[model samples]
Target: MSFRVFGIDAVSYSTYSRLQKGLHAISMMIIVWLMTSGYFAAYITRIPEVKEAVSAFNVALATLFAPVFVFRMCVSFGKGYADVLRSNDVMRYAAFVVHNLIYITTLIVIVSGFLMVNRDIDVFGLFYIPAVITDPRLHRWFSDSHTLACYGLALLLFMHVAAVIKHHLTGRPVLKGMFF
Candidate 1:
């Protein structure tokens, strides 16, 4: 609030600016939780006896959040271009929305991965499911889906961070939305 650019006060963006900033921060915290849970499910529980448990955790998370991500993306389409475009005031929301989409889409990848893993057991020690297959016939299918999803997410994230940096270099409030 103290800073001004070209004598133009930050008020030009209006009060939604602060609310939007808060949303961005909250969204990020949620994503961190989602990713942490995913990492634990995917990488930490590696025992064959409990492998299905971890994969099941990822599946539940994905199925639950997938709809939420779709809803968010759908809402973004309704936003006015002026409001949605890359402005410092809006960048956090934009970044948050973009990553939410990424996280949500990855749900499909995770589910597909569990199928690919081909183990049948109770996931997270709750639900019992049969193994997908003993043979690796569908290995390529799962690998391709998971790999492609990760690569796409990585590219989108890179472009996103780059845009924020660009906004900062150009003296926009891009960093402000994320930090404060």
Candidate 2:
């Protein structure tokens, strides 16, 4: 009666745990890089090639990351919502909310990135995803929202990491649950 990842009946906790860990690690690394990429591009723009390279890299990373993230979101919330609700802990619920927000914001940022005009992206060096937005107003709006969402994601990530460290320091095995 429950949703399963890939409809596999015997999927173990260890399997989902590993999937979450890998996806989380990838998400964190990409986000951290993306947070600074704007500033980095500005600084290196004197060499126009570097700016182009940076833009291409950003698009490529997002292209590869999108599906993995979407998959993780699907698998993570499947059947876990009931467990989260039944736990009856405010902190756990808060953590779940923060996690969902992080995922939502990241997806928003990714979509906005895709919508932004002027950047030509050869995703994974195979196919190109062109900028479909040409309206200056809408483009600016999405671009600005993408930037804000990146900042919000950074803040959420900091809070999440701090909570994990706090749990580890306070001898709550919740941090260990993430690993084993």
Q: Give Cα-based local distance difference scores for all models.
A: 0.58, 0.74
lDDT computed for candidate 1 = 0.58
* Lowest summed lDDT window (length 10), candidate 1: 7-16
Scored against the true structure, residue 63 in model 1 reaches a CA lDDT of 46
Task: Give candidate 1 regions above 4 Å deviation.
Answer: 1-9, 12-54, 81-139, 175-180
Model 2: colliding residue pairs: none
lDDT of 1 by residue, 40-121 (tens): 6556876765655544665555445545554544544444555545556665676657756665655555556556656664
Candidate 2 least-lDDT 10 residues: 2-11
Best by TM-score: 2
- TM-score, predicted candidate 2 vs. hidden true structure: 0.79
TM-score per candidate, chains pooled? 0.52, 0.79
